[model samples]
Target: MIDRVWTTNEKFKKRSEQNIVARSSLPWNHSCGSKSFAATMSTKAEIPHFVDFFKESHWSKKKDDWLDHKCMEKHVELENLRTMCSQPDAIPMSQEEMSISVLGKKSGYLRGYGVGRKPSNTNTTSRENDGEMIILREELSSLKELNETQQNQLVRQQQQLEAQNEQIAIQQRTLEKFQAALLRCRLLSSDQCGDDSLEGC
Candidate 1:
C-alpha cells in the first residue's frame, strides 16, 4: 500500500509539472492569440491603403509638378536666349563685358556731359566707377552662390522633414497598437477577476 501511494504521488507530481510547463508555454490568455491575429490583419490591411494614398496624394505630386514647371521655364528661357544670340546684329558679349557695360555706365548728367569736368576729376571718377563695377560683380557672384547654397539647404531640409514625418507616422501607428493591446489586456483581466474562473477565459 505504501509503494502504491508513493507511485501515485510521483505520477501526480509528474502530471502537475507537465501541466505547468504547458501553461507556461501557452499564451497568457486565450484571447491573446486572437487579438494578435486581429492586430496583424489590421496592420496588413492598413499598410496597402496607406501606401496607395501616399502615392496618389497631392503633396507627393506637388513637388514633381513644381520641378517640371521650373525645368520648362528654364528651357524656354534658354531657347529665347539662343534665338536672340542667333540674330544678325546681335552682339554676343561675354558675361564680364556685359556686366561692365551694364553696371559701369553712369546715370544722369555725368553720362550726358563728361567734357565739362576737369581731366583729374574725370580720371578720379573713372577710377571710382571701375572700383564700383568690380564691387558689384563680386557682390552679384556671391549672391548667386548664396542662392545656390540656399536651394541645396532647402532640398536637404525638405528631405529631412519627409523622413521625420514618415517616422512620426510609424511611431503613431505603433503607439495606437500598443494602446489597443493594453485595453484588451485590461478587459481580459477585469473579466477574469469578475468570474474567478479559468474556464470562461
Candidate 2:
C-alpha cells in the first residue's frame, strides 16, 4: 500500500510540472506581453496630448529620463520581490515579529499625525482657566450659603425685637393704672380728716 501511495504522489508531481510548462509555452502569454509593451508605448506617445490638454510643457527630455528612472526602480523592486518569493525561508519572519513591526509602523504613523507633540501653551492656559473657573464657582456657592444663613439670623433678631417692644408697651400701661389708684386713695383720706375736725368743733 505504501509503495502504491508513493507512486501516486510521483505521478501527481510530474503532472503538475507538465501543466506549468504547457502554460508557460502558450501563445497567449507571449501575446499578453506584447500587448503590454504596445500599451506602454501608446501611453508614452499620449504624453504630448496630456501636455496640450493641461496647457503645459510637461513633455521634455528631462521628464522622459525621470520616467525611465522610475521604470528602472520598479524593475528592481519586481526582481527583489521575485527573489523573496523564490526563497521565502531565506529571511523568515515569525508572526510575533510581524505583529511588532506592524505595531511600530502604526505608532510611527500616529506620531507623524501629531500624537508625539507636546501640548501647546494655549492648551495649558485653557486648562488652568478651567480650574480657576471651578474654584470660583465653588466660592460663589459658599458665599451664597453664608448669605442665606445671615439673612435667616437677621429675620430672627427682628422678630425678637418686635416681641420685646410689645412687652414694654404692656408694662407701661400697667404702671399708669397703679398711679391713678394711689391718687384716689389719698383724696379719700383727706375728706375723712376734714369730717372728724367739724364733729369735734
Candidate 3:
C-alpha cells in the first residue's frame, strides 16, 4: 500500500536524491525495459503513472567507485509533478514497496548511483530501512500470534491437570472406604461375626 506521508521527502531524505538508477522498478512499471522486473509485481501496479520517481539522465560512473557515484547533471522534473511539488512543497512519489529485515544494519550503497539519478524509493528502495521496517512489523505480528498459541496450550494443560487431580481424589476416597470396612470387621469376635456374618458386618 502506498502512503502519502512516505511520498514526502520527510520519511526518506536520502532516497529523495536526484540520481537514482533503479527508478524503472517503480510499482507503476512504465519503462518497457523493466517488463521482466515488473512481472515480479502485481499486474495492477504496472499501469504507469504520468511521472517516474527518479528522473533518469544517461551517464556513467568510475569502476569500483561505480557504487553510489553522483552526476553533476541538473535534475529535470515532470512538468506536472514540478508544479505540484512547488505548490505543496513536497515531492510526490509512491511509498517504497521493498521489504528488508528490520533487525539488522541498513545498506544503501550504490551500484545505485545517479546518472539522471533521482534518489529512487520504490519496491527497490534500500531494503535495510523502509522495507526492513515492513518486514519487522510483519515479524512482530507473527510473534504475537505465536504467543497466543502458547497461552492456549498452557490453558489446555491446566485443564488436563485439574481433571486428573479430581480422579485421584475419588480414588483416595474409595480406598478409605474399603479400609474402614475391614477395620469394622476386625472388631467383631469369631462368634459375634463369623465368616458368614462378616458380610453383614
Candidate 4:
C-alpha cells in the first residue's frame, strides 16, 4: 500500500518536472472558462482546484481514504496555501517550495498509505515470507525428534515389564517343586510310625 502511493507521487513529481498535469487537459483540469481566460486567470480563480489535479492523477486504489486523517491534514495544508496565494501581498512560490510546504511530510497520504517512508515492496515482502517458512520447518523438525524419543522410551518400558513377568513365573515354579517334596517326607514318617507300633504288639 505504501509502495503504491509513493510510486504514484514520484510519477506525479516527474510529470510536473516534464510540464505539469501530464498534459494540458486532464480529467481534473477542466477550466471554468475558455483557454484564453486561463491565460489571464488570477490566483483566486485557480484556488478552487489547487490540489485537485495532482490528487486525481496520483491517488492510490483506495480513493475513499480521501477522508482519512493524513489526507485531511494535507488537504488543509494545500487549502491554506491556496488561500495565501490569493492574498494581495502573497509571494509566488516555486514548485519545490510548494511541495516542501504542503507535501514535505515524512509519511502518510490521501489514500491512507505511507508517502515518504521506506517502501514495503515485493522484494521485502518475499524475504519476510521466506523467513517465516524457515522458522516453521525448524519447528516441525524439532517436533518429529521429540515424537521419536517418546516412542523409544515406551519400547524400553515394555521390555522391562516383560522381563519382570518372566522372573515371577520362574519363582512360582520353584515354590511348587518344594511343596511336592515336603508332602512326600510326611508320608514316609507316618508309615515308619505304624510299623514300630505293630512290632511292639
Candidate 5:
C-alpha cells in the first residue's frame, strides 16, 4: 500500500521517509492505531520480523548497488513480506512488529552489500522459496481434482446415452412381435371360414 519510491543514499533517513503510506482509499474496518491489532495475532507472528527487515536499511539503487542480483531479489521479497504484514490484511503487528521482521531476516543481505557481495543463490537461501512452491503445488493439485470430476461427469453422460439406446432397441423388438401376432390372427380367421373372399372370413 505504501507508494513512496525508496532510494539507496538514505535508507531509513527518517521515520517519515521509512514509512510507506498505505493505500488510503480502502475502507479500514480495523484502524492501524487501534489496540485491537495487538489482540488478533500470536506473539510469535511474522509481523515483528517484517518490521525488522525494513529497519535494516533499504538497498541503495545507485553507487552501492553492487550487491548480488539475488540479494536484490531478496530485498524485493522482504518488501513483499512487509506488505503482507502491515497492509490492511496484515493485522495485529501493524507498525513496529512488521518492520522488525523483514529487517531481521534480510540483515545478512544488507551486510553483504556493504562489503560488495551478492547471494550465490537466491532460491535456496531460506525456506521462503520452498513455502511458495508448496502453495503453488497445492493449487495445481486442486485443479487436477476439478479436472477429474469433470471427466467422471462425462463418463456418466456416455453411460446414460448407452442405456437409452438399449431401451429404444427393446421397444422396437416389442412392436415387431405385436405386429406379427396380429397378422397370424387374421390368417387363422380367414382359413377357418373357408370363404371365397378373405374379407368375408
Candidate 6:
C-alpha cells in the first residue's frame, strides 16, 4: 500500500514537472486581476488533474472493494446453501434447481466465475492482479536485499571483533614482559646491598 502511494505521488510530481495542464504557461510569470501582485500560483497549480486523478483512483478502489465484498457474500451464501442442502433433513433439490439453490448453474457461475470478470473492461482485473503480483515480487526482492545487507554488516562486525581480540592479546603479552623485567631488576639491586648492610650491623 505504501509503495502504491509513493509511486502515485511520484507520478503526480512528474506530471507537475512536465507541465502537462498548460502548454505555454511560464513558471515565473503570473498576473493578478490588477489588485494584488502577491497572488501568484504555486507550483502545485501547474498539475491541473492531480486531485481529480487521486480522487478517481480512490473511488475506483472503493467501487472495486464494494463489488469484491458483494461477490464474497454471494460465495458465502452459496456455500451455506450447499451445506444446508447436504443435511439429511433438507429437501432434495431438483435437476433444474431454484435460482437461490447452491447447485443452480447461474448462481454457481456468477458466484465463482464472475470474480475475475469485469463487464466494462475485460483486461482491467487481469492487469490489476498482474500489477499486484509484480508489487509483491518487488517487495520480496527488497526484503532479500535488506537481509543480504544485514548479513554483510554482521560479517564486517565479526571481522572487527576478531581484530580487536588479537590486539588485546598482544597488549597482554607486552604487559607480562614488563612486569617480569621489573621483578628481575629489584632482585639484582637487593643482591648488590650485602656490603653496606654488614657495616651497619
Task: Please name the candidate that would achieve the greatest lDDT relative to the true structure.
Answer: 4
Question: Which lDDT tens digits does candidate 1 get at residues 37-79?
Answer: 2343344433222112212221224345422343344334434
lDDT of 3: 0.42
RMSD of 2: 28.8
lDDT of 1 at 200: 60
Candidates' RMSD to native: 47.0, 28.8, 18.9, 22.9, 15.9, 25.7
- Per-residue error at 199 for model 5, in Å? 14
Candidate 4 lDDT, 1-201, residue by residue in tens: 756765778876576556644445332222223332223233333322335543433345454444235555666677678777566444444332345577663333322112332222543454457766567657766776877898899999999999999999999998988898888889999999999999999
How do the residues 84-191 of candidate 6 rate in per-residue lDDT, one tens digit apiece? 656644543321232225323543232122222222232345344666756765776677688789999999999999999999999999999999999999988887
TM-score of every model? 0.35, 0.35, 0.32, 0.34, 0.32, 0.35
Model 6 clash pairs are none
Q: Where does the lowest 10-residue lDDT sum fall in candidate 2? A: 49-58
lDDT of 2 by residue, 89-115 (tens): 333222222223332344532211112
Model 1 residue 190 CA deviation (Å) reads 2.1
Instruction: Give the runs in model 2 whose Cα sits over 4 Å from its true position.
Output: 1-128
Q: Summarize candidate 5's per-residue lDDT along 87-199 as a digit string, tens digits.
A: 54222232322324543434423321222222223322433466665676577667768878999999999999999999999999999999999999999987877765666
TM-score of 2: 0.35
Full-model lDDT for every candidate: 0.49, 0.47, 0.42, 0.53, 0.47, 0.47
- Model 4 scores a C-alpha lDDT of 0.53
